[model samples]
Target: MNENFQAILLNVLPLLAIIVIAYFAMIRPQQKRNQKQNALINNLQKGDRVITVGGIHGTVKSTGAQTITLMVGRNQELTFDKLAIRDKRPS
Candidate 1:
C-alpha cells in the first residue's frame, strides 16, 4: 500500500507540475493577448485605420453594436464583425 501510494504520487506530481508550467508559459500569455485585443476592439472609433486578420487594411467609417463599417476604397464600404478588426494601423 505504501509503495502504491508513492508510485501514484510520483506520476501525478510531474503531471501537475507540467500543467502549472504550461499555464504560465502558454495559457497566461494567450489570455493577456486576448484581453488586449478585446480592449482594442472596444476602443475602436471612426476614422481609425486598422488591419484585419485577413490582411485587409482600411479606415473605419462607422461602428455598430457588434460590427464596423470600413472604407477600403473609394465609394466602397465593407462591414465586418468587431472581432475581425485585428489591430490599429500605426499612424
Candidate 2:
C-alpha cells in the first residue's frame, strides 16, 4: 500500500509541475497580451493609424461603436471589426 501510494505521488508531482510550467509559459503571458490588446482597441479613434493582423495598414477614417473605417488606398475604405485591429502606429 505504501509503495503504491509512493508511485502515485511521484506521477502526480511531475504532472503538477508540468501544469505550473505551462501556465507560466503559455497562459499568463497570453492573458496579459490580450488585456493590452483590448485596451488598445477600446481606445481607438478616428485619425489613428493602425495595422491589421492581415498586414493591412491604413489610417482610420471614421469610427462606430464597434467598428472602424480604414482608408487603405485612394478613396478605398474598408470597415473592420474593432477586434480585428492589431497594433497602432504613430502618425
Candidate 3:
C-alpha cells in the first residue's frame, strides 16, 4: 500500500509542479500586462498621444464608448476601435 501511494504521488507531483511553475512564469505576467493595458484603454483622454497596434502615431481627438478619433497629420484624422490602441506616448 505504501509503495502504491508513493508511486501515485511521484507521478502527480511533477505535473502539479509544472502547472504551478507555468502559472508564475507565464500566466501571471500575461495577466498583469492585460490588466495594465485594459486600464490604459479605459483611461484614454483627448490630447493624449498614443500609438496604434498598426504603428500609427497620433494625438487623440475624441473618445467614444468603443472607438477613438486621432489626428495623425495636419488634416488627417482617423477613427479606430478602442482596442486598436497599443500604448500611450509621453508628452
- State which candidate has the highest lDDT: 3
Worst 10 residues of 3 by lDDT: 37-46
Model 2: per-residue lDDT, tens digit, 1-91? 9999999999999999999999999999999999999999988888999999899999999988888899999999999999889999999
Better of 1 and 2 by TM-score: 1
Q: What local lDDT score does residue 56 receive in model 1, on the 0 to 100 scale? A: 97
Q: Sorted on lDDT, highest at the top, how do the candidates line up?
A: 3, 1, 2
In candidate 2, stretches whose alpha carbon ends up further than 4 angstroms from where it belongs are 1-7
* True-vs-predicted CA distance for residue 49, candidate 2, Å: 0.5
- At residue 66, candidate 3 shows an lDDT of 97
lDDT (Cα, tens digit) per residue for candidate 1, span 1-91: 9999999999999999999999999999999999999999999988999999899999999999999999999989999999999899975
Q: Tell me which of candidates 2 and 3 scores higher on lDDT.
A: 3
Model 3 residue 27 lDDT score: 100
Write down the worst ten-residue block by lDDT for model 2: 38-47
Clashes of each: 0, 0, 0
Task: State how far residue 9 of model 2 sits from its true place (Å).
Answer: 2.8
